[model samples]
Target chain A: MSSILKVQGINKHFGGLHALNNVNLDVEQGKVHAIIGPNGAGKSTLLNCFIGRLTPDTGTVDFDGTSLIGLKPHEINQTGVSRVFQTPEIFTELTLLENVMIPALAKRDGAFKPSLWSSMAGETEIRDQAMNALSEVNMGGKAGMTAASLSRGDKRRLELAMALVQNPKLLLLDEPTAGMARADTNATIDLLKTISGKGLTMVIIEHDMHVVFSLAEKISVLAQGTVIVEDLPEKIKGHPKVQEAYLGGAHL
Target chain B: MTVEQSKKDKIMVIGVVLAVLLGPIILNPFGAGYPDLLQKFVIYGIFAIGFNILFGLTGYLSFGHAAFLGVGSYSAVWMFKLLSMNIVPAIILAMVISGLFALLIGFIALRRSGIYFSILTLAFAQMSYNLAYSVLTPITNGETGLQILHGDPRVLDAAVEDGALPVTNLFGLNMNATADVSLLGMDIQFNAGYYICGLIMIVAFYIALRLFRSPFGMMLKAIKTNQNRLNFTGVNSRPYTLTAFVISGIYAGLAGGLLACTDPLAGAERMQWTASGEVVLMTILGGAGTMLGPILGAGVIKYFENIFSAYNESELMDVFSFLPHWLQELVVSVSSLFVGEGWHLTLGVLFMLIVIFLPGGLMEGFNRLVKLARGGYRKDGASASAAGKVTAE
Candidate 1:
């Protein structure tokens, strides 16, 4: 399989402390790639670099053969690299349908196109699409409800619907199940598994071992800003370096 | 998209149409039924409606919108001087020129949002005011103001041998010409100028209503809700905001043009910071985000201004004639501070009370009253919003 996203020789530092040290990753197309590590593993920082939320001190992030080093967040998003943040970034003041429709409009119309003459109530196609996406997340009944009224899990699902409405090439799941209860986490995993089955590339940064094992086809173990092992989920499960990286520090 | 909702909206539209059409007759009781004041009502109604589009939809608090009003007035007067006394050219030029002016100011002011954006617009307006007052006097005519002169070349109109200034006209109809009607022993004067402004005001209100339901309007509301998320959603917010700002500016310009069309004069004083502040006050007082709020606010403020400022010591005595002589004297002396020249002080107090008690403006107050009538009264905005929330249970 061809790798859709390739990170090479990444190095980042914050003042005197090194945040990432020569981290490298290869995420194959149409596969679920999970990046697992401890709390300060630089996983989120790496994800931020991918999404253009942060500029690495030195690195080359290649997606679809073009450099993503300096693109604006919106420009990077336009390249079909959409992100689901851990905190769930959605338009809280808008309705769920509106929140979902906005991303769909962006995906269809590109960065900015305001149809002043066309009323939202008349956009039956977009409304249907938004409703379908909402239904996919089981929040179809609440499409008219304000997103601010949604619970934590519902907000995340609504956010997922928002992302999925775009039909992005690469979906970056930043701990999609973080802070979720077991039932909700299991539901999210099943939803992600269904999405993964449809041949969409996803890069998930997760701390939960069960989620990492159940979903990821391939695993990359990260420790102190560097990948310690890159292998199938089965092999990466019991690797000595992976254990040391999870338990100890600074050992090859 | 609900049928009930759409039906209600249709009712509102019909209501607004009726209100605007019958304004002169309805306002006869308020002593604001005169031609000039009625003209001011719809003119400023258009102004506030446009203001709501920006501050209401996108949450951009501009403090320099009066600059466009002033710009419109100046351009209309210039058009009357150079092109024709016909208001069509003047109003059109006013819209176009104000739109361009807004584009220039919005392009710069939109670069910084929140208070910085407001301050930038205020500074630009203050600069425009100062320029029109001092340096641009050749065009603006400085302190004396720019008015149509008898010998000035009104190229479109025939050279008047009568040695009098030409009045603004649409085709052959004079703007200030009034048709008085006696209904139920009360006289109602429908002025040609007032109807011109009134018709335009309806169109403006309708356009604003259409925009509120449009996807573009949704995008604006999204920008207001969360601009960062909007950017991340791959929508460039700057252009949308700039477009809204310019549209609002054009609206202000049209209102200004109508001002000149009714009374063929333009002055730099219209661009004063207080004028800008007044539009903001109207929007907030009516309710910034709702459709009818700003226009309602403009009417209420203008109504109070006309009523309170028209009262003198003698009028006060007439009002308090039932009270004893010494008590009447004391009351009139105390109450006089909030009337006549002190009308602004009354406006200031009302504005503060609205901001404190009804943060959502008159619209929320009306909503709350409706809710109370229906036995569903909630204490505040938070609880009112929360009352409608759908839980997962």
Candidate 2:
């Protein structure tokens, strides 16, 4: 597969403490890549840097052959890279359908369309697409419900649907199943597997070992702001460094 | 229930339309006595609606919006003095100046959110008010306030007797014509000033309504709800917020200009921080985030401020003179507390009650009542639904 994303010599610092150190990775198009690490291992920091939320002190993230260093997060999203936040950041006051429709509306021709004397029905096709996205994530039944009413897992699912409606080329998932119950986590894993089957490239930062093992085609173990191992899941499971860091960290 | 709700809304719209149409006649029941109170309601309604656009939807408490209002009124009055007695130019200038002020203030205020943001706005407004009170005396006319002068320059419409445009016609209608029509035995006067203010209010309301639902508006809502998530999603919320602030500022400007047009005067008091606080009260009283709420809030407050406050003990005595000596005095004293200077105390208490008991303001309270009347009240456990709705916005 062709490489869709390339990260090189990524380094970040918070005052004197180094958050990320020389982190490098290449994500192939249509492949699911997972980044796993103990808490404080700079996994989120690396993802944030890629999406332009945080600028690395030394490094570059190139997505689809375009430099992402200076672009704003929204610009990066417009460029086909969308991030699903760890916390489901949905418009609480809006209904599920409205939340999905918001991002969809942003994709319409005019960024600022007159809402007065203009019916939302004008965007019937886009609305249907948003609804389809909801259904894809099994949130179709709750489409009319306010976003704040959703269960934690469902909220995450709704957020995923929002990103999917954007039809992004590179999707970043930050602990997608972080707060889900066992059943919900398994469902989320199944959902990710289904999406991966459809040829979408994904980079996921996950803490759940089961989820990380279930969906990731490639695993990268990060510890102390650096990638210690980049290998197949089986190889990662057997790697001594991965065992020493993640296993030891997990035990603690 | 839906049918009943629609009917209620329809009734409200009709009532408002009728009241506005026959405002002067109804206000001055004993002929042309004090129609000024009705005019104040419309003017302040415009102000509160503009203020609500920022504070209500965006969840930004701006304590300096009055500065924009003052800037607008001053600019408008200057326009009338320098150009023509016609209000078009003055109102337009007012909106433009207020919008500019908002742009500058918003840029500084938007740099911070929450309490810091509120303080920044307050400081800017206070600075403007102080400058108007002192340093900008030349333009602002100092403490005595600005009024139209008889010999003021009028380059645009100088009663060109030779071969120029006639008395500045606003949309081809002479502004000072006495055209009164009889409606339901009451003389309804369609004056230029009232129509101009009403037209501006309509336009402002339309623009606000559009902004409330637009993609840009949705983004502001996102910013209000979850700025961090919006950032991660790749949306720069600052520009969106600034744009909303500017739009709201323009609305306040229009209201300020209308105020000047009605009275042909502008005062430094227009930009006081207390005026800013008044709009906040208006928004909370009428229900923030509701389109008609702020307008309703403004009307209510203006009614109390102008009409209720005008009443003294004599007015109460005139109403209940049939009572005995001691009881009549007692009635007048009690009535005085509810109206006039003491009205603000009632406003403050009412505002607090709404904030505590009806946090959603009049709109939410009305919504609940409608639901209850329709037998759609949910069970006790269903409070989750309402809680969810509240948190979502």
Q: Judged by TM-score, which candidate is best?
A: 1
Q: Which 10 successive residues of model 1 chain B have the least lDDT summed?
A: B384-393
Candidate 2 residue runs with Cα over 4 Å from true position: A108-121, A249-252, B1-16, B22-34, B160-192, B314-338, B379-393
Worst 10 residues of 2 chain A by lDDT: A109-118
| Chain B alone vs. reference chain B, TM-score for every model | 0.95, 0.85
lDDT score for candidate 1 against the true structure: 0.89
Model 2's CAPRI class is acceptable
lDDT string for model 1 (B44-115, tens) is 999999999999999999999999999999999999888788999999999999999999999999999999
Model 1 misplaced regions, further than 4 Å: A249-252, B376-393
TM-score of each: 0.95, 0.88
